[model samples]
Target chain A: MEYIIISTGFALALLGLWGILSQKNLIKIILGFTIFNTGINIVMVSIGYVRGKAAPILDVIKPSEAADKIVDPLPQALVLTAIVIGLGVTALMLVYALNLHREKNSLDINSFKDLKW
Target chain B: MIKKILIIGLLAGVGLIFFDLFNAYQGSEVLGKTGRYYAENGADEVGAANLVTAVIVTYRGLDTLGEVTILFLTAAIISFVLKFRREDFIPNRPVRITSELLDSASQVIVPVIFMVGIYIFINGHLTPGGGFQGGAVIASGVLLMIMANPNFGISHKVIAKVESISGIAFVLIGIMGIFLAGGFLDNRLLGLGNLGELFSAGVIPIIYTFIGLKVGAELSNILGTISHAQNEKN
Candidate 1:
């Protein structure tokens, strides 16, 4: 399960990277960015996965026994934080895309060559 | 042609690394020391049944604070950059009403959905969910209302009030922790009521309540601004 998850996540990240590097449409690039974010989250989550362990909820078992039974809470906590921040970044990027579209009347990012050296 | 080859080469390098990682990743059979510590002592130390909640709200609290600030600023910037003239705004074209039944059904269902969001956040410490999930759910409920009635609008005043008050309360509670408990954002501000109970986690539920309200308000505010701007541009 862990192997499958991590491999799939890596594949997704690669797909997103390809989209960003190849796609002309700004929106496609943004979609790729989100996919990449999701892939990173999946990898981070699977990294912390311990075989046959439950979630880190103390309600089901005594606190002393929780150490062996529970999966790592640290990665879950960090990933949750990362997901929230990723959403914010994506929203900001989208707004920027909208503004660019308004100014240039084009969604194709390649059309904006002002930065090309 | 060169760009394509270079890209392929880069992708191949990535593929190789992935293959290597995949081959080497033996699933951990033991929790890390910190994970072990949180799992064992979190209930007694933070009094929260959910260790993830304990980690986010109490252990790594300062990080959560910074995260919410990032959300607040992103929301502020989105609205700022996308400001549109209301007088010049063109409303959405009226789509033929698909189902009177669906529209009426939402009236009952939306409130229930909204309540479920509230329940999730309030019981965050004892459950799998926390503030962010609940807030997103509430925002979806508000969004459903928007779709059902094109003219239906949330008062910005109410949103702003809820946002500011909760944000203030969150900060104040963190400050109160300085005096009432150990460090900043400490969960032991009050007595750890009871394990696995509604109010068992001191300050966690309160903090999550504030977070849920603030996040919901921010998301709704973002949606409101975007929809209005799109209408104006169209």
Candidate 2:
């Protein structure tokens, strides 16, 4: 199960890379970035998965038996933080795209040649 | 054509690296030392039934503060970069009227969404959802409101007030933890209450509430800024 999820994450990450590399529109590139961020989050979560273990919540399982009952909590916590940070980063990227579009009146990456060599 | 070929070659090289990393990953049979300790003692020590919440809100709380600061900086930078005079704006484009279904549905659904968002953050200690998730949900609600009415304007003064107040309160609670408990951002400042109860987990709920409010305000501020900036297109 973990392997399957991990593989799926890798696939998504690769797909995102393809999008980033080939896309001409700034918004599409930002979408690729978000997809890449999500793929990484998924891989991190799957790494923390314990086979046949429940979620890290102790609602049903007693606290004494938590070690054997729950999956690792550290990655889940880290991923939670990552998800929030990703949201912030995505918002910032969109704002940047908006400004870029305003400046050039074009969303195509090829149109902006001010910094091109 | 050359650029496309180069891109594919680069991606193939990256894919091979990923494949090698995947091959070497041996799934762990047990939790690491830190994870094991948290799993065993997290509920008892933090009085939060959700172990992930316990880890995020207390065990590694300073990092959470840093995460919030980063979010604040993102919002600040976006606002700074997108600054424009509101009064000077004029929308020359034809206004698109919202559909009747959406217009009516948003009126009924927005309030419910806000309520659910508040509930998620308030029950952070016992549930899978927490402040960030709740804040995002609330921001979605705000987005829906804007979709329903393009003329809708979120008051900058109100959102700024809420954001700053909640952020200051979050820091204040962290400082209180230093004086009242083990160290900074300690959830035990007020003593852990009954586990699985709404009011349990010492200051976790309070801290999460502030975080939720601050995040929601900041995100709403971002959305409002972007949407208002759209008027410049006209």
- The candidate maximizing DockQ is 2
- Candidate 1 residue-wise lDDT, B128-152, digit = tens: 9999989999998988877776656
Among these predicted structures, which one has the highest TM-score? 2
- How far in Å is the alpha carbon of B91 misplaced in model 2? 7.1
Q: lDDT by residue for model 2 over A70-90, one digit each (tens)?
A: 889999999999998999999
Share of real contacts kept by model 1? 0.88
Write model 1 residue lDDT over A4-112, tens digit each, in one string. Answer: 8998888898898888888889999999999989988998999999999998887777787888898999999999999999999998999999988988999998789
Candidate 2, residues B1-234, lDDT tens digits: the string is 999999999999989988997898877778888999998788778999999989998999999999999989998998898887767586543479889999999999999999999999999999899999899889999999988988788999999899999999999999998998888998888879887899899999999999999889989988988888877643
lDDT of 2 at A107: 96
lDDT of 1 at B159: 91
CA-based DockQ, model 2: 0.82
Model 1, chain B only, scores a TM-score of 0.93
Q: Which stretches in model 2 have alpha-carbon errors above 4 Å?
A: B85-88, B91-94
* lDDT measured at residue B44 in model 2 versus the true structure, 0 to 100: 74
